[model samples]
Target: MMNFHFIWPLSGGLLIGLSAGLYLLLNGRIAGISGLTASALGWTSGGVSILGLGFIGGVLAGAAAVFALLGHAGLTITSSPILLVVGGLLVGFGTRLGSGCTSGHGVCGLARLSPRSMVATMTFMIVAAITVYVTRHLVGGF
Candidate 1:
């Protein structure tokens, strides 16, 4: 069976919630990574908001720090570069089409008890389950 490590996961979840709450409290903004990234990249109307750029930088720095401290042995991608690129493009498109990413709907919106977020989160979970089933069972995932 799978080994369950509750402490790390719980800590991570708490950190995420705390960070999101802090962002909202400080900036009056929802901590959605996709929106922040888009704004940082100058794709949004404001054209590279400093707030978004700072948040993205913090995210990257935090990830690098974690990787440096813990060492991620399983971080290598098994799929082809083309597949990875395509997957990323698809995810970006899907996030735009959906008006928000999983973090936005699942974390912030759900926390606020939003009906639209409830529907979006359910859709995200269902689609993820279907994708996993198809990849693992039907196509044999890499």
Candidate 2:
């Protein structure tokens, strides 16, 4: 069976909504992954640390389950571990500089109608567009 479904965009949206709503109603915290992870890493808030780790674990587990069902055919690109690591590092750095990742700023922050989040989301969108353009045309690699 071909499972050509956008599960995360749908199910992940639901989970994010639930998390955000619960965070506000019960804890009064926004479900921003970068903020949560920063607090967790800095040990500033133990509660956020636990939630951040759980959120990350859930995301990874969900991705792994999807890949298992999808058979992991296009997981690799360019066949370079070093490039992949470098790319990951750059992404993390950008996320830090931007103060929130796509999920946080794009989904949670925007939903909460935060001006900071609005700008941050726009930055991500613009940066992503430039990245795709460079990757597809300028650099020309898969």
- Say which candidate scores most in TM-score: 1
> In candidate 2, which residue pairs get closer than 3 Å at backbone N, Cα or C atoms, i.e. clash?
none
RMSD of each: 2.8, 3.3
* Residue 41 in candidate 2, Cα distance off native in Å: 4.1
CA RMSD (A), model 1:
2.8
- lDDT per residue as tens, model 2, 1-142: 8785677568877877887777767877767776777765664544456666776677678788878977875544664798778888998898878877887788778887989989998888888899889888999765
Q: Provide the global lDDT of candidate 1 against the true structure.
A: 0.88
List candidate 1 segments past 4 Å from native.
1-5, 73-76
Please write out the lDDT profile of model 1 over residues 28-121, one tens digit for every residue.
9889999999999999999988989998998889778778878884366688788789879988888898899988889999999999989999
> Per-candidate TM vs. native?
0.88, 0.74
Error of 2 at 75 (Å): 3.9
Off by over 4 Å in 2: 1-8, 40-48, 64-76
Cα error, candidate 2, residue 62 (Å): 3.2
Give, for candidate 2, the lowest lDDT window spanning 10 residues.
39-48
Look at candidate 2 and tell me the lDDT of residue 142.
56
Lowest-scoring 10 consecutive residues by lDDT in candidate 1? Answer: 69-78
